[model samples]
Target: MKPVDDDVLLTEVQFKELFRDQSAIERYMSGPHPLVLGHRVIRDNRFLVKISPDNLTAFKKEYPHDPIVDLLTTPYWFRVHVYYDIVTSEDFVVLTHGKPGISDLPVVRIHSESLFNRFPLRTVGNRTSSRSR
Candidate 1:
């Protein structure tokens, strides 16, 4: 897969649509394998995002000991699995090893949608919403 450029910022609508379907999230979390190799995050102007290995290296050279790099360089194999536990009223996010039968890591559950896809669609549809069905 082509690397996502750091310049991209996901919009609110795009984020919501991706996570709009609770079932889809459940499927992603409980299906046979749902480990995500990479993820996208929003950063301010001071923060530089790099996807290419070479770019990342260059960035590290310029900003030695940058915490953002540490966050960006997290291992892709570390899986953050999302599941809806019937016992709980809301969804949960869990981090686990990509391999099966591995122990799970601490999880941080956030109630938000992916902004990239949701935002652009909104912008595009704003003009056409009334004209189209």
Candidate 2:
């Protein structure tokens, strides 16, 4: 995620005050932080979030560290990872932000690919960092 120069972005002091012991900045600087990095620029690194009625809750719980969630809780902001389209090779992703007007029904969005910009889920030891059904 690109760092913002304006005060509109979260402040370090505010983060410290809010999280107290959180190490978001450190995690962001190191590797592919799930919260900061978006979908991979290629065909593989797409953050494939299969949304459904059952798995949606679990997904949100699992990615509590996701900054997009934080942004959504506030106003005027949300997170969307662009993916690559297989046919046209366009940049896209099903993006959502701000308050939802309805409690049911999911929206349709486009997905495209980026050759260089991507966030492949990391593998730790024997398990994959990505969650899939």
Candidate 3:
């Protein structure tokens, strides 16, 4: 991430406008829900989702793959993960499978929003936070 330009400043109105633009971009990029960081267990399998700077650093140490993690969200082992060119906006669960060295495990990346949007399901929304799932 690049440092903020200290020399640059914005008025309150400009800041608010920027904030709104950012929110729209995030929603369009990620989906309806906002991003959150944490770990969860789905269907008795362990998952670790790291998107925050601190957590990404920690995940990088073990997995050595920054900005990418996978989740096996189905009984048939369908893999899913957050997708972004530089950083992830979509919320996803990274299934650890009760093991270490997450990068060692084979996975296929899927943009959660795209998946849900492209194939709208009766129960599935555009995108869901891991906690909600």
Per-candidate TM-scores read 0.22, 0.23, 0.16
RMSD of each: 19.1, 18.2, 21.5
Ranking by TM-score: 2, 1, 3
What's model 1's overall lDDT? 0.39
lDDT of 2 by residue, 35-75 (tens): 33321121221122111223324546877765434442344
lDDT of 3 by residue, 24-104 (tens): 425323533323233233223222332344443444467654223221111222233444442544445553222325344
lDDT agreement of model 3 with the native: 0.35
Pairs that clash in candidate 3: none
Runs in model 2 with CA error above 4 Å?
1-8, 18-23, 37-59, 63-68, 76-133
Best-to-worst lDDT order: 1, 2, 3
- Per-residue lDDT of candidate 1, residues 65-127 (tens digit): 744334344433445566664563445556543233233222223455422233355465564
Top lDDT hit: 1
lDDT of 3 at 51: 35
Instruction: Pick the winner on lDDT between candidates 1 and 3.
Output: 1
lDDT of each: 0.39, 0.38, 0.35
Q: Say which prediction, candidate 2 or candidate 3, comes out ahead on TM-score.
A: 2
